[model samples]
Target: MERCIDGVCSGIFGSAVFSDTVMQERLPKPIYKKLKKTIKEGLPLDPEVAEVVACVMKDWAVEIGATHFTHWFQPLTGVTAEKHDSFLTPTGDGKAIMEFSGKELIKGEPDASSFPSGGLRATFEARGYTAWDCTSPAFVKDKTLYIPTAFCSYNGEALDLKTPLLRSMEALSKQAIRILRLFGDTTTKRVVTTLGPEQEYFLVDKELFMKRKDLIYTGRTLFGAKPPKGQELEDHYFGILKEKVSRFMHDLDEELWKLGVSAKTKHNEVAPAQHELAPMFATTNIATDHNQLTMEIMKKVADRHGLACLLHEKPFAGVNGSGKHNNWSISTDDGRNLLDPGTTPLDNAQFLIFLVAVIKAVDEYADLLRFSVATAGNDHRLGANEAPPAIMSIFLGDELTSVIEQIETGVVKNNGTSRTLEIGVSTLPVLPKDNTDRNRTSPFAFTGNKFEFRSVGSSQSIATPNFIINTIVAEALSQIADRLENAGDFRAEVNAVVKEIISKHKRIIFNGNNYSEEWVAEAERRGLPNLRTTVDAIPALIAEKNIRVLEKHGVLNRAEIYSRYEICLENYIKTIRIEALTMIEMASRQILPATLSYVRKVADTVASLRAADADYSCVKEELDELVTLTSGLKAAIDKLDQKIKEADASEGDSLSHARAYKDVIIPQMNELRAVADRLETIVDASLWPIPTYGDLLFGV
Candidate 1:
């Protein structure tokens, strides 16, 4: 394993990865320098340079016991997709030589029709290309060398998350550098976005997890009565870890660390058996890759520890669900945190401009942000007390809000000093979250520098949300740069823009409780769109303004946008359909049969009591109650089955089909679950077909 040097991160951090340290150690100096320059400047790798890097990378991977290589890419299916190829090349003899070429390293073709292309290609097209993303590092896992790549169609349409994400990063950097030049910072080069997504999950005993068919089919529990004690006492949060859970975490961290993922923090979450792991910040695209790898490693480690890790947003009902809080920020290559309120006059002026750009961007394109995190699993979690509300609002905290207010009113008042956050104000105080009452309820909150997008679901890939953030913020900065670059008095114009931005976009900056009903009502009054569901949020991707901005910034073309829009709806429609089918199957095969068996036993007891000439009223009453619930359960199953069949048969567009699932099918699923959960409480433990919520949550 690599170790830290001089107290700075070096080989110890990304030891297993084909990281910079390994490249420097192995590659010839000229080739290494050329490769690094190309990556840093976001330029295509020269063929000769790629040839050398590929050979060195292959040797490193082979040395690490990697026999096969995979082009690891994120498809539109909201998960990663990869196609593995062996490194062995036949040498015309019985034996073969391990060989990998620059062409193989730079690109590969896979069957495009199988993955969700969202009509970007025909079913018979069967061709997709994976281009090597030289920016993100390669790593070896399970004897397979996984090279990070950007997937696209043969026609060059982005069919994967990383492609658009890379485009957005470049788009943002282009505009940000323009902004930086206006501020007279020419040596900054590239402005890179960073992300640190905190992942939350639940770990259950593997046996208990397998017993529940719903947990097996869907990631969440379809039907389980609430356990008596939940997160109400808040004792589980940050509490002492159980020995088994601790062992799992330890193993998880080790695995993730070897893969070069910065699995920084681990602790108990609000719910029983729930835990969270947060990583240190990394380049946005690399962070997304690390997050996906982290989630995959988490499950593998848990299974080795005799546990099953649940990444579903709402794995259990009536408890705190999981969320992936994306902490995002941007900084210059020369090491300047753009969001930080710097002490010097020049620094303060630049920070104020960038800060206002984010404020204006969030206000103008809140819909895109919401749509970024939209998912069928997340629907059950959002707007709940445990997670941030569905409404898109920013929490700037009280002190920051005060600074913005002073800027808005043109009053420079601060603790017996004429300090202000307004641009062009030479004397300013660097007060970073001194009085920030952090609001967990806010969807997007400013925690000192970075904005934590708390609405992202745990199971989701962070690429989509981050790309949206990058594009929107880039658009805002582009608009500001147009004014600043052309203005005769740049500083005065910067101050004016900052003031106008805060004044106009102040509605997005809320320092109050976001979970309150008043906040919802006030959000509506402030003309904010409350897109509360995945279906409701999906259309925002294709909205006119969103499309315009995305095109203007060259992040995603209209066709690419429409394709993703189709995919999102399709994903939602399929997810609900699968869940509904799973419910119908569970109720009919498992819950109903077991329930009826218990009902028969109860009826037998009633008959015995009556025959014995004893008071039969109590036993008879129990039998009657059982029968009633059993009837309701049967009826609920039939209704869900019918609705699913109808949805499958009668579909106009994916949107309407998705609405049928959301509006009609989801309500019926709840109705079915209610009756089935009630039966779990009354039925005998031994007679029950599956493990109860208590067992799944606490048995671990």
Candidate 2:
């Protein structure tokens, strides 16, 4: 399945993208400057500029073999959506010409009722608008001009994740820029949030994948016995890639490069059949869009290599799962990273201000932050091996923790554990980004310059987590800016503010193992939120404090917030319901039937041995084990089916329904899976009914 992409060239990186370079090369200078202004400053796009830009963009797309165009947008379904239309328009003289108009480029209407709106759009109110978001680039994908856009309902309520995400960005920028001005930084225009999300996934043979109905229906194995050799040897982490995997990664990188995605780092992850890909940073919205594209393209590229890419948070049991580390930072328009703590007093104070602001933000809104990454798939991954716990805490490493403590207690103390590197000449001894060793077990760890939110699941959109991040941090920065905007001595106020924040919110900072039971008790003692699952976390979305912050920043309206809460509850209920049904089907229709056939064979052998008067004790023992398991399997299936009936019969409110699924159905489903997985160990390999963990994890 190796693909030989011919005619590789120097210009292949963004060949398909209508990027800034492409825009600059093809557009009139005046038009290009105006468009850049619109993109940077969040100004309205002028009709004349849009017309000219549309003309140039169409020309470039046509040159690259585009025949149709789509208003590509991200909806609340946690995925991207697009509808294509031909560029050809008929003439009165029975001839047609290809054209793209400014009106067309700026706006499109897709059916509102079709997308998940969380009741924002009624079924009969089938109108929604997709407005062009000039911030993210357009690219030619699959012979179509894919224009990135923001979707909204006819009433102007945000219907897609992109709209709220963009709003949160603007909110953060407005507050952050105000803080920059107080630092006497008049040259900086905009302060934008950047994200460098690392993606992790599993690659299994497509043929083997198709054999497992559980994987196909639920995106995770419902019943997998522990493999004889899992990732226990620790040999798979950073191991040499298989030949087929190497070719897949090579083609994947090239395809992503053509689409202007900066897929930077690729390596074997901690589990067998598991891998990770990290990208260079981009603006938050663009990075969100790029991540969606990356997930889509990963599946396509995997299929081409005869592999099935598993992006489920817990695709396999008894081994490491996948997570997307959300690396977040802020930067000024003129290229100064706001998070970088430099040597000078002004820079260090500024960095600490933003740093404590994040600490304060995460502390006050830890529950909401926990809620943002909540989903059914992630429930299995969180608090498990290779994934952080459900509790929200920050890891600042020893060096930075000491710096915060000195600011807090005014008594300098250091832990003996130390490592030093010259990142920059810092008034406080500087440590390079590498010196602060990565805390893989920490849920929210501050890397050298950015906060890596590690709770995000691999298959998630990242829009919710990032929007919540931007909104909460914006609230924190807004308060800090208000405190300092009128200060007579701004530098003096900065230190006081940072110290005050550390005193109050430093409880959120913990540089210890988040996975330990001791840490769980410690987190409870500190009153930190330990939202264990999506069902436990969803109610935080509608909490008055969370709603107030979201509203204050205009990231989401009250109605939108409630809609999201309802949506979260429904999504959780539906996901578990589907998983429950899938388990029933696999156990009843496949596993039990297959196992029974084997049981019947054993019974016949035992009977023949007894009739022959040969020693039948061993044969009787085997038959007894098979009979007991078959009876248990049938009873477990019946128990699961009855619970599903009760859940359906009493399905009332969304929250209650979700609880039914989570409390009753999920446990019963697990009970069934336990018996089935045990049966797998005893049954013949060919009679096990489906692929085992050994086949799925190592067959490739």
Candidate 3:
């Protein structure tokens, strides 16, 4: 119940987490030091040390009134999964005693077949293991000790998102260290990728949400007419929060804070009913875990306040969709942000090298970057005016772009010194943080010290995107290190590498509007791959170059790569299939019937008016329009049904099947929606079966 408005609430923050502070306080010094070493250095945990740590963890959990423990992990389903076991062990005398073992703490067995393995494991091959991820702290949730873990199959293939993510983080760190050594940074042992995921979502009344079958079934309004008043006036952005929403957010922050999630900022988003929560940055692994927990907590807290949190990328059309802006940066264990362009960026050779490496990675592997954010839900949001385009591009602000330009050409020009902004009134203070204007349209934008990846879907786990980024950048860094380590002159070699990278990858940098058609044509001219849909983008995962880089870094082997490709395609097809079926059911059962009733009422009114011997021209015209719309709706429904049947019966590989859904079935569905939405505009509000967009959007 503690609130953190301006000052820190010392004891309330991380109250439920088994954090490093908790370990230092509760655990013996030697055991705590050993465990810290294992966590920081990635060394194998000593059995004796684990036994002592497990005992202390169990005691702490029991002290906090937890009777059960669970190994929480992130699976391919894009959510956290766990199986709980009680602490009580039955003694021979029929009495129970609390017990926990090092073996149990270190590993767990979960059924792998039940989860999506995508040909990695057969139905009968159900074995999977969850090993403790010691770096991320455990926490108490719902009277259970939740230990973060990494999931894998019996043959050691990654069956969950966390396994590959952890591997990719290691890969990035190893290569980044090598690059740092080339820069004479021997004091730094590891370089870790850090992330701050800004989550955007919508809150709707729970009662209204339940009434909408599409929202319940698909997490979006599959068919709804655009409301008269949307975000057209741009009044919702940064507006004052409503009382109910403020209460929900306060509760949400408290819940997240208990689990050690640094929920820092909350504000209204660009869309009605839409809001955003931004957390402080953490190491990539812990940040991913905290984000997953934050999302779950958001929904749970909303429910308590009689609301449903909608995390879909586009829950409503004609307004802004939600996105998780991944603020990503790299740092060393010894406290240095690699992407930090200090006061004089031109003098910071290390920062320039790292920045160029990111640019090169994003340019060369644009397809892979596109694939990471590809999903059926996101397909509707990307390339729209509200969201970034499907084309991958980076936006380095004026200062860095000028630096890069100087590096590309052999001319170093002083791009004017930073100046303070003055207010017209002398009483007002000057602002200092306005070094550069922000471009929200860019997919990847440099925001001062870090890059913000704005194309990630709201509901995504963020693990895949960060890992893909880590792996690609690691490859670029590895290539740079290879040249530098063998060079006769380190400084000269660094400059040569930076220049070559800038020359090759400068096309990916654009400060203009990405949503413009001209940019699309320009990107095509520059030979940038524009994978516009989930179907178009997912194929990049299996491309030879992508596979080679991933395998070379040991992030994913060939089989693992293929499995993920299959899984992504399968998930896309299934999502579309479910959405199509839901649309068909709603169109035929709810919308068609409702419109037919309204049409019958209109026809009856027209007949009665004609029989009354009065002027019935307006009534007749309304009747004619209703009849035409109803007929059009019927025809659209038939066409959609036929297309769905054809898609269901089509035979091909996963990619081909997905193509059919995307190319043929989706168009048919859009046709059906057009007719249904028109019907909604004409039909009476009482006759409409489901909640309309306005009600769902503004009712909360």
Candidate 4:
């Protein structure tokens, strides 16, 4: 509980511990300088220096009460993984000595068989290696020294998300450096992609959350009757947080801050019980690590406050679902924002080149980029009215659009009129207007200085999407750099490349409403991809163009890409299959029994009334209608169960199986839900085993 100049408790890792004590005191000055160079300039990690750093890391961790150390790596499971080992060795005299070697610190062995390898490794091939990622510093969590690392298979195939992500970042920096040299920016040695993913989640009271089997099993409500009031009033969005939720957020931020995560913003989201937390931007790799930690810490901190955090993309139906908006941009090592267009357009050609590269990248690789964010849980959220559509379009606001349009037609935008900023009182400050307005509906919208990838799911690992972004942008930059290098006049070539990209890929740009029907029709006419679901998008993962680009840049090998495609399909199918099973169980065990119990009570009431008086026909008629509806519901539940069993029995390629789950099994389950939901409305609440949507949504 230490505090920096900010006054809030520094949580665990104080700034003093981080800067002066841990880094400055631990490493020799030359080694420290070299390590920082590797981190900043995207250089290779020297094994000899890594060993020296590891010894220092172990001593610091042990001093902080750490008995074990773990190589923390992010796998394809969309979560972080670690294998812990104690730093104790037995002596001959029944004594033990604490020991953590440099080799032990730099490497780890985890069984590759159990993890979702997507056929990267077979059951018999259980070997996997975790190499310490020197760029991201090691830190202690829960008494374990957590060394951030990249995981790979024994045969050198990338098995984890972070490895390819790091590779793609390197690729981007290399290509971007070439452009920077061309622009005569010699001081900037490296370009890095940075991300600040805003995570949105729903927090429900623990007791209420536990009451619903759907929420417990699926991490989202598979079925629930509509609440009387939802976010319809829009009162919940950005409303003051309740005391309980506020305490949870406060504690959550403190915990995250301790781990070096810049948990900067927290507020209520568009839905009741939904909230968002945004961090300051960091290097994409560190940001990925921090995001995984943030998600884990969010759940742990919520438990401390007697709540359960729901990271499911569509935890509730008929409401705005949670999404992680990835605000991504690039920067030079010398502290220049590459995407920022300065006030004067004529002097901002460098920014224009980078901006056009991003636009061209999104246009050329839109399908692969879209596939990055595709997941089963996200499938429920994407393309809904609340979220951006699957069609990829760049929303550059009015000013930028006019600039690009003028460039395309070779006309001077704004008619060469520079309006003077004058204040009436001659004392007030005046400023130039910004070039573009923000568009929320476009999947990849260009804001002032960054592209906001709005389609990333709240529960996603961010690594994949960022990797895709880096690789695609690298490809575009490579193309631009090649053209400039070959051209006789560098300035003419730069403008020609910009104009050529804008003209050829201009169809990818759309300033109109992305959610409109007209936009969809226009996208189709423009020959843009509209990959709507995981089923549609997974196939694009292994397309020749995507494979060639990924392989060419060394981000992912052919085997690795194929493995990911298989993994995605399998995960999608498995997720739906589990949700289907959960639905059937809830319907059979909870809904049907509760409805029947209520129906029996009603029949008893009718019989008792008839015994007391003669006018019992009204009661009898009401009972009869209830009995018929319950019978229909019971039959639908049976049919749903049968269909799910049939789907389980069917077998084929992963994609075919996934389609079965989506088309055949899901519809049957929804039909059963429709009937059961109606019965919930008619049945007595006391008999219901599960909490209703109203209770879960509003209880917080």
lDDT of 1 by residue, 301-383 (tens): 99999999999999999999999999999988765678888778888788888888999999999999999999999988888
| Residue 384 accuracy (lDDT) in model 4 | 87
Q: Which parts of model 2 are misplaced by more than 4 Å? A: 1-10, 413-426
Clashing pairs in 4: none
Mind giving the per-residue lDDT tens digits that candidate 4 earns over 1-700?
Answer: 1113254554443431233347777799988888888777767777777778777777787887888988899888888999888888898799998787778767888764688888888766768899887767677788888889999988888999999999999999999998888877777777888888999999998999888888888899988889889999999889999999999998887777777777888999999999999988877888898899999999999888889999999999999898999999998876567887754533377778898999999999999999999998888887887889999889887777767776666655354764422111112111223434467788888877888999999998999999999999999999899888788977677767888888999999998888888888999999999998889998998999999999999999999999999999988988887888888888888888888889899899998998998688987887887898888888887887788777778877888888988888878878878888878787888998798889888887
Score residue 456 of candidate 1 by CA lDDT: 97
For model 2 the TM-score comes to 0.96
The candidate scoring highest on TM-score is: 1
Misplaced by over 4 Å in model 4 are 1-21, 343-347, 416-437
Backbone collisions counted per model: 2, 0, 0, 0
Which clashing pairs does model 2 show?
A: none
lDDT of 4 at 466: 96
Against the reference, the lDDT scores of all candidates come to 0.89, 0.88, 0.88, 0.84
Q: Name model 1 segments beyond 4 Å from true.
A: 1-13, 414-422, 433-436
Pick out the ten consecutive residues of candidate 1 with the lowest summed lDDT: 1-10
